[model samples]
Target: MKFAVFFLATFLVASQCHGGSFRSFPLEMPTGYGDGVSHDDVRCASWRLAVEAQNIFGFETIPEQCVDSTAAYIEGGQYQSDSKTVNQQVFFYASDLKIQDNDVVIFNVDGTVLSNIPYYSQHGYGSEKFNSTRYDEEFVNKGDAPALPETLKNYNKLLGLGVKIIFLTGRLTDKKAVTEANLRKAGFHTWEKLILKEPSNGQNTLEYKSTERGKLVQQGYRIIANVADQWSSLKGGNQGLRSFKLPNPLYFIE
Candidate 1:
């Protein structure tokens, strides 16, 4: 006779994008822990939690290592949305982990993600598909949107603190000039860098953002925070020190 044993586990990755970028060090699972338990199972569990973090709280990635007797801990609404407040903490059981905070932070340009756009109407708010014509129209009209008051205040405050800021967006790179104009028009005065997606890039948000962030790191920049509305903008490598998310239930990308 064979018996099955279920195991609960948590793992962490450094520098994941959660509405903002933050560093999350990985934890090693103990050896000879459970029967029939594979490393992939642990990773899958972690990935599921990461996905939930993004779906529910707009976290680009899980900020901390979490483990529980069952996966229900996360499913039970124990972790709230990150957008509700800046200082809220998510609870998780894990061995031992350490996080390092960086000084530079990255922001997504989409008003739904980071900056608030009071004048910009959320046209694709209820769209089912992300690559639809309506989405394209929305992006084109983003220039007409004005920045949100709270977001502008935070941007200015971070800037005043001498924290280097980078603007990363999935907008077509061809619209670089126009995007810059729109940002300035919307009161975004200064930034260390502005990254836009290229037409030929052929990479999803996760791949594109991760690759770009890696490039920045290679260039000697430390990414401490990442702010975005979409999960794609947050996942992947070179995540950073912390991540902050904005509410966007309109559409989701695989």
Candidate 2:
């Protein structure tokens, strides 16, 4: 993703015009992970809790078909969108947030990073289909390269630290299972959360996850931090949520 000042300006202006609302309130990253008794340590506990929740109940394991489909889209070509400028900006912004193994990133499909899903959708691929079917043995057996290998590896380290790993995305249901499978095959040893887009019945998957997380938080699990390249993740007024703002290199959402 390439960065352009013009696109950034446009994104800000467009967001204002659209009256977009984000929930996350940014907090400074603690100097370091401190002892569990310190204030920073409490924050770390919260973050760790969020990560663990993702590992335990995020989504089912990913299937091989999703992995192949994702790879095919990347190897094929990018599909152009009307908001080309902002998409490019988000891509570039997200790149700066990439800290090579230190940061735990929840990449936004529509904003932080663009996936092959769009390309496949445009090309009449089977990715648009969904059913009760989840990731299966057939999909796993025919796998190629994982869809997001590097991202998965970075999260894996967090898992090794006893920190929970998650992949919080707003992907369509059809692609959600496959994406999870790809991460699993790529050596992400933890069961990552796959946040899917809401269905036509007016369900908000993110909201549900947020509610579920609140329960965890009340149970004494605090979210240490969450990093994303887009404003979408911060739709509420919660200040304890930690976020890293980076330019969106890929022009995704307007």
Candidate 3:
């Protein structure tokens, strides 16, 4: 009887250590196919990164990557291409703009979602006009766009906690001023890194970003997490980066 009791106690302790609470969540990509983003869902890639960082390291919140027209636009409605495997027409229509001043919308299109046609809509800087050359500027700015208040709030909280914050994106780099104005309008402030895409440096764009993330890792700055709409970005990041994603129905190009 005594031996059995002791073994039972040991088993219970071991079980707890290996259970959900004891282990990290299985590394899975964010769900793409959904009715759309729900306020309470809290499952976007960016949000996932933030949550993981908070849980693992004592970080405050997750950072975000905001793409702009220059990055999405390929040739002024000529069909902007993404680095993801899927081919998509990315556009952000003004009609899709906020009907209410504070109205917010979340896009989610992945599995079982529509396969073809443009995914997102935009104003003047349509995906058609997207040019990779614009990112030549060292400092890329972010612009104000409709965003989830929750995301901004969490990012702010993280910053307030003394965590160094940075921004990364495949957006064109030259339009830093416009991007900055947009981000401010969207309620973001004082970001550290605003990484943007540059002309292909002989390597595939996907490989380039992956290499960069590795370099950042070697710099001794522990990457707590990464959030993005695409899988390539998630895969390219450091092993320590907790990845989170949101709904991105559009296609991914590289």
Instruction: Indicate which candidate wins on lDDT.
Output: 1
Candidate 1 least-lDDT 10 residues: 87-96
lDDT of 1 by residue, 1-254 (tens): 97554554443433333343333334356676555865554654555455446523323323223223122332243322333343121101000123223356687887532342222224222212234455445655556556644456667766655677789988888778877887888788788889998889998788989999999999888876677767778778998866666544333443
CA displacement after TM-score superposition, residue 98 of candidate 2 (Å): 23
TM-score to native of every candidate shown: 0.58, 0.41, 0.44
lDDT of 1: 0.56
Rank order (by TM-score, best first): 1, 3, 2
What is residue 225's positional error in candidate 1, in angstroms?
0.5
Distance from true position, residue 143, model 3, in Å? 4.2
Output the lDDT of residue 21, model 2: 28
Candidate 3 has a TM-score of 0.44
| Model 3 per-residue lDDT tens digits across residues 68-155 | 3222333333222222212111111212222322211111111111111222343222223333344222223223244443345445
Model 1 stretches with alpha carbons more than 4 Å out: 1-84, 87-102, 112-124, 127-132, 138-142
The TM-score leader among the candidates is 1
lDDT (Cα) of model 3: 0.38
The parts of candidate 3 lying over 4 Å away from their true place are 1-144, 200-205
